[model samples]
Target chain A: MARSRNHEQWTSPPPFTQEEYVDSRIYSDQDIFEEELEKIFKKSWIPVCHESELPEPYDFRTTTIAKEPIILTRAKDGKVRAFLNVCPHRGNMLERAPSGSFLDGSPSGNPRHITCMFHAWQFDMKGRCVYISRQEEGYQDRLKKSQMGLRELKCEVYFGGFVWVTLNDQIDMTVEEWSAGSLEVLKPSLDEEPLEVFHYHKAIIPCNYKLWHDTNCEFYHDYLHYHNRITGFNDAYFARKNTGFDNGHINVGSFEVQYDNYEGSHSREEISFPHLPPNHWYMIDMFPGVNFNLRGSSLRCDIMTPLGPNEVMIEFRGLGLKNDDAVTRRSRIDHHNSIWGPFGRNLHEDLLAVTGQGSAMNPRAENRQILHGRHENETIHDENGMRHFYEEWGRWMDRMPSNPDKPFVERTTATSATG
Target chain B: MSNADAVRDSIYRSCMYKDDMKWQEWLDLCDEDFQYSITAYSPEIRNDMIYLSGDREEMRGMMKMLPKHNTDHSPLKRHCSVYAVDLEDDGSMATAVSSVVVYQTQLDGINSHVDAGESKVFLVGRYFDKFRISDGVAKFVEREVKLDTRKLDKGSHYPI
Candidate 1:
């Protein structure tokens, strides 16, 4: 095997390395971010919209896939589907609201097709354009409804009733395969009943997506949490096992923290709920931007988008078992917010740490990030998870990971450009 | 004091003492049947969503259990200044509107504040609230703190 090298340099460091990285690379490096938008985000099956958000026919919620706008809606048959949120005519955004049922200004609760506010161009739940304003007079029969449906995205629903969509039709991996390790952490909650997101919070962290992901992927930074002393985050038993699979996807970090591991990544900590393990924290970095975390009884799903190299927008969704009593659900929400909410103790500290890093690293290109973990352990685990990401990144960007130190490679074709 | 003044003073003192972290003094000002809450307008439904609402016992349990959990942000400082008061004829009840600015100070010394709201009051400024108060001068009969700022600056584990 090639001798593993630390990519840190004083004069000019590679944008990212297994070691510390410079701050400006995160904020200013458009080339690196575009590669991520393609290799990881566009190809990966991302949880675009939730099934619960669209309970009735024609009910819809518009969301983003990287920079591409998409909408999720329920068909007349009650099947959930995903479509590009842009209208077929005039390129106007079909729905302007951040989240709601429909955009036609019609009374809510009544079942009706989605009608674009611009020209009353209506679409069925399947995204087929059903009605167009003054159809027979101006345009004649040239505009076929068959060719004018809202562009559909590759979509699927998980066993837990969560909805996910992918831009690439060629990628063939089940949600189970993509989220293997995370599913273990999620099993306890999933085993009970289908989970629904009751509470949602978002923060646009001014840092790189990887910086925030590293904050969750590693367990060595408890000293930063001032409250961790009381919460038992200081224990040395908070060990982590980093594992990565083929295709540079499905990277998992499992910790043998101060909690009881019921079986897999699941833990029972007494800090929040007595049933929740105090010592366990498991996170799965799903290829590009999405990171799913199971911190005991509560579930936190984070989507980090590269607003730019330096700025990352992190949206958090909190999930709980569907049949929870009002009190139990509220308690879980309290516990989740206490630790990881935008105002929570743990996440706030982590955000500060990464934001501080962003400020310093972006301007100085010589810094590198250190990820030297257990390489010789019995299994193929190490900072290999991080390495796999860069390797895949290198593969897609036409750069060399073995020599990621080389000058940046610029791509002529926009990664978003269609084949 | 007139009944209107009594309810007005009661709401003022309760908010004042609560801001000072004087949980006991805040509880003492409330009536046995008092009701209190903190709510927000959800633009999704164009309706109000209550973030916190409870009686004295619920308040006590919340205050008791809050410090035990972990949190994401920093300390919050609330300033509630009453601007107008509407009194009932018998002085047994009253309605009060106030403006409030809640400042949340982060560890890095960053502070963000929510600066607007209106409060509805009853039993104009009294020692015991018109509603039933519970626990050791440690709770309220009823309370409601509504927020005009829909998107919170940074959330806190405790009520506003």
Candidate 2:
């Protein structure tokens, strides 16, 4: 048999041994994907939205996590709560729209309640089922509508900015621990002067959820981003630092970006975020699916959820300071749009890479080899971020991502996994 | 040509120039102070949103770096019809609204099969524009795209 030459970098400085290259099976196999939905997606604490989304009591934003629909709402008591969007009776969706206020907007003066369109079952902002149709006449003795409220999940608003929830409540570790101390480091920057999300959009891509995430973690893909190359990738880019904590969380340091280096590029002279200076960046990739980031004058957060084996939904939010003037807000908006907007110059190229890699790594195609062995002291070009992430991924699924295998947990256990 | 007709032609040529990838020609048509943005409203959050925004210099920078980026080979063809044109009383400025629908045709790459080459409606929107008319020529000062379609299939690197 010929020697396996999968890991060698034919042109680059560092050489990758066979162990250095990631195995192709993780990208192709169905068994490993299912395990991820349980071990990673369900168990992870995913950020749902910025708390500013529902500033008033009884306001709510609805979203999905790991294919499970969820609703995040503010209570009358000044607390944010999360629940499965499913109503207990007949499992109908409580709120069908993406977001809304429980308080009646009309002059009809109807009291605030979370009412299900079907069956006329009414719930309060705290998810208490206050009214049930025909409760007195039918099964009054046995059925207790008061006993049932919308199913609640463990939800917390972090650093007074983001709302995060976990489907598995017994995961033991707190949000701070799961993030491995990075959350604290980031909170000060996020909260100091306060930032509000000014832009929001979601795109469903034809790629695996992990593939969509790889675009963020893999640094060598910089070659694919011309704008980044032209205005970025200078001495500062090469001098960047990366830190990886436990549980697959990675924070890559910033290189001073010169947006003016490219022709027609304008300077971000006004409106930088709370802690950052002009043209600087801060990024944190939490394992599984959330990325909180700052670049130049705009702050952004992206959350990815798996739609299927071959599909992923990504939500992007652009943020600015709370007190920006019209010009500063416009400058922030312009800065945000230039790079992170749905029509951004960077994202399309990243999506193409993810989808293209997905297409090539499909089961029918020959199983391939992917390398994440670069070690330039964990700089922008290093593959250690991806490697660190996959290693943590392996620990959770109990299967090395490179040499993939099915991880079978009891089906009863999985029921709670979706809680 | 009448000033109104000249103004109308400039707007028509802007869309055509963009569709044809005649970048420099399109840049020449815009005023020095051009500002372009794509804006939308989300009933979900009850807020108006900005998907993209830039001025002339920023637009120029994006175009300059566009060539080096790995972009989709799906050439977008825009179908636009001028809906209304209102020149200001001072005649120094004008505003126009146009209905626009862009179709994407997969023209390049391994996936660019003949079947995939069939164009499809990518987005539907109205273009809200402002122009500065000087020396009997109209150049774009601002273009705000009010989009109706929020569920776009892929990343839209190019302006609508």
Candidate 3:
């Protein structure tokens, strides 16, 4: 925590080991940010949207991943697909709105197509170029519509209500393989219980994307959130487990968070997803930036995409069952909004703390060490998930982090150093 | 004042209480059955979106705990223009539709020279409100803040 004038304190020989600390350079360095963008975000299976978002054929949702425009669509054949949302014909932008449907031009008299508002070039849901204007009169012999098609990305819809996309084609791994055993822990809720996104909102924070993920993995920051302190620090809360999966994914399974412990809040019912016991608090940090969380009566998914080195855009969604009655749905919405919304009891504080951390780390003037080495047999209090994340980050960047400067090194005095 | 005039005046006063950060005064204007929600639709995801929904008790608890929470200090001034006020045929409740434009001024650390002097438009929305008038005084029964803008900056804590 000390930014002493002596860089010696940073490189000091005998503080804590690499297990508990990460180099601050990862947060501040521009070159590292660029490397992370190319190596990690471009290759990871980023969560795009829920399948229900585009339930009808030819429906599409547009978003940006790592600063590149992307479109996820349910094609006419009833299969979902992903493509780069750019017009092939003059390289113009496509789909200005966040989402829309391909109209059957036959209504007015034309073929059905995902029409690009620019230059009127139309593409089918399968990324095929269907029509080009003034084709017969000019350049008919030179230009062929069949020869050009929109660039496609690897898209997969898993058992959970999420759509995952990746940019790299060289990799042969499937989304299920990448997320091995991660959804198994969620099967009782995600697999059997049907769900749909009930609420959607987005906000932009002026900070690196990873800063937001830190708020998810590190449970010690609960002290920063007063409302969480009231209902989250009980004995049952600490007796939890964090399971680390391959490829930087980790799931934290904890006992029920008794929201009823707080004065005005009420107890939860058995209306949680299929087979999920009341008060169950489960969360998955789906490596890179997609997160799925089910707390008591409601579920929320948050996915982030980097806008720049110092800014990130976060899309938040709250989910509930498709057939929930009015009472159950209201309870779900109430529970979700209380903890996950922009004005939630905890999210506002989380955003503030992360943005503040980003601002403090944005300046490279000081050498900072982020201490994540807390261990309580991998309880909710453990920082092992963070350690897992950075190890993957280090593998991608091909260099040891500069803050802690060592990944596997041990500092036996870590307990005292935390003092 | 007449009942309609009282309803309009109460609406203006409610906006004043919110703008001035007078939480207790604002709460006093609400009936026991009052409900407040901030809602918007995202064409990106779903047809109906509920950003924040709470009843009178939940709001009471929130206001009680607000001072202890780490909330944004940036002040917001809501500019409101009442468009239509209509009393129901049965006279049980009255409704008012006011177009609201909220400007957020960065006073603390997050607002630097880039956003120092100008109070930026934080959100543009309409307040669809229901009131119960008794003896020419109006008490808020329900207010649904249907926001047209979905993207928010870092610092919005209060209901818009």
Candidate 4:
């Protein structure tokens, strides 16, 4: 084919249906990004942190969902709770650190209480206001402690002890319902024994959060990962299915990785999770950006926070069985870090690609068509994972993905199986 | 040169070889059983984590495979300052502490038009290095990179 003229270059569309491509504006437009946070992220169930992260009473972790600060604590009753990390008095952020224990007293806080450094307000692990400086003298019974308690959010600890929270108080679905069985494939392995996080790191990538999730959704990009290409391109790998679930979740079926195919790489079979076949891998990409990947020996969870339309902060956690002996734990860490760590063989390459995409689709850049056109019987190389996700995204935003100017219309074809 | 100076020289040579992407030259400065690791303490998880670790042979294999993988070809210049060297009584072994600040020059890819020739700090860390001196020749036995910067943007295909 001859090279196109300038007008044709700008006007021509790819020879594919609307479902096969989405407008680049969905990734680079500030207005669409903010509306996504409100319509999709805020209303969806998000895994804030793992329950094991706050094992002891008064242990707390602070995070955000759709930019609303949240604090999760292990209360005296041994239940995990989530609340807005704001001092009701003046809306000051209550916890400044990423994580800590409230058991020790600070200069401005009492033992076993969440403290607001701005005004010295204190709340218990359950988020009940325990102390307020000069409450009776200043307000004079106008604001009681009962009415000043922290705003509690809906929280649940399930599906392998992840603490799932939602900013919407009236969300209709439970965490299980939200997952829609996307996690069933690895349920036995993940729930067989308690898990403990052995590694934690985060990177602020210059890319939209969905782009990172897109990386997780499909295995076609394995071409970009030499490690995966060398070890995972066998017939079994190509035959593995991409199963889409409701609420934008997708699962890549298990496939045995030939770990020893690569030079200096060792088989992870010996330390495979309980009930899991040696050398097998399974992955689940949850809606609005969360990934749970179970390689033979370790479980890696990626939680994304959209800092802006063109930037995202991804927290990476690697977990092993809590009862792992020192030697076993060391081996698990090695297996995890070998592929997924910040300096890992594969993750840096993924980050590099996404950052490239981000640079090309910055807010000022002209909108272009981003393709998702491949079709391969819903197998590993199929693009249905992303197509299904955008279908749901269009529903939530009530806008067509290919043409954001038009309202969303449901397609009649059954591109995905119901989870 | 003094035994301590020899060990310091070995450390400096390793940095230069790494900056030049001369993997074999860098490996030549290490002992047969040398261990290399990049570690950091994450306040988020309240734990010390190792991001990368390998023995000499494993390191060699990884470096050999670098060409097959997609990597950022931007050049890295490591500025290292050896702060202290403690020589053992026999002068056969020494331990050195140094501060490292790595700067990367963006020279390739899309941003080159705007960022080419511009240098940005890539990493800040301390190196705890141990060496074994044989006949006045020092080779690294172990090097632990304890990094202060945890949020490595886009990270690196090679070790820091």
lDDT of each residue in A1-419, candidate 1, tens digit only: 65656543334444544322322353346776776787667877788645666666767777788788888887778888888889999888877766566534453212367777778888877887888778879679887777788888888887457688888878777777766454554455454556767555456655677777766644456566544443443323333455655444443434434322111112335333223445455666665666777665677787676676777777676676767787777666665665665445567567767766665556345544344343433122334455445555555655554344464443354421100
By DockQ, who's the top model here? 4
Question: Residue by residue across A223-290, what tens digits does model 3's lDDT show?
Answer: 88776778788888788777788787888886877777777887786568887888788888877887
User: Candidates sorted by lDDT, descending order?
Assistant: 4, 3, 2, 1
The most accurate candidate by lDDT is: 4
Q: What TM-score, computed on C-alpha atoms, does each candidate reach?
A: 0.73, 0.89, 0.92, 0.97
Model no. 1, DockQ:
0.15
Docking quality level of the chain pair in candidate 2:
medium
What value does the lDDT take at residue A146 in candidate 2?
72
Candidate 3 structure lDDT: 0.78
Tens digits of per-residue lDDT for model 2, B94-137: 99899999888865422554436777787899999888998889
Q: Which 10 consecutive residues of model 4 chain A have the lowest summed lDDT? A: A410-419
Tell me how candidate 1 scores on lDDT. Answer: 0.58
How high is the CA lDDT of each candidate model? 0.58, 0.77, 0.78, 0.90
Segments in model 4 whose C-alpha atoms lie over 4 Å from true places: A2-5
lDDT of 2 by residue, A155-264 (tens): 88775478889999788887777788766556766878766778888887767787777678766788888778888878998877767777788887876788887666
Error of 1 at A374 (Å): 7.6
**Of the pair 2 and 4, which is ahead by TM-score?**
4
The lDDT, on a scale of 0 to 1, for candidate 4 is: 0.90
Q: Every prediction's TM-score for the first chain?
A: 0.79, 0.90, 0.91, 0.98
